[model samples]
Target: MTILLFGVTKDIIGSSTLSMPSSSEFGSKRSKTVKELKEYLGKMYPELKKLSSLAVAVNNSYANDDTIIDNFDEIALIPPVSGG
Candidate 1:
């Protein structure tokens, strides 16, 4: 699965996109949930946990922790944003 990064997320990740193992490729332990994905990312990118907030989008829609991610689904990481 490829996750699109935005704002600080992009800078922290050092890439606009990140590739993760698909469910079918690594089996059940690999995780198929958005929450799990977050935890996985936090582990890989420790800086992510320091962000003010983080949101996950699946197929262009904001996704919750329980959201299941398919192997071919479109994923994106939305970082905190503030403007005056």
Candidate 2:
């Protein structure tokens, strides 16, 4: 699966896009939830954990931690933003 990173997330992750094995390719033994994916990303890129707030989106809609993700699904990572 590929994750599109935005804002500071892209800087933290060092790229605007990240690719990882999907649950299907990795098998059911791996986690498929957004929460687990967060954990996985945290481990893979510790800088991601330093963010004050992070948002997960699936299919263009905001998704919660418990949302299940599939290999073919569209996912994006949103970082906090500030504007006047």
User: Which RMSD values do the candidates have, in order?
Assistant: 2.6, 2.5
Cα lDDT listed for each candidate = 0.85, 0.85
TM-score of each: 0.87, 0.87
Q: Which stretches of model 1 miss by more than 4 angstroms?
A: 23-31
lDDT for 22 (candidate 1): 49
Q: Which ten residues in a row have the lowest lDDT in candidate 1?
A: 22-31
Cα lDDT tens digits for candidate 1, 1-84:
788999999999899998875443333654478888888788888999999889999999999999988778899999999999
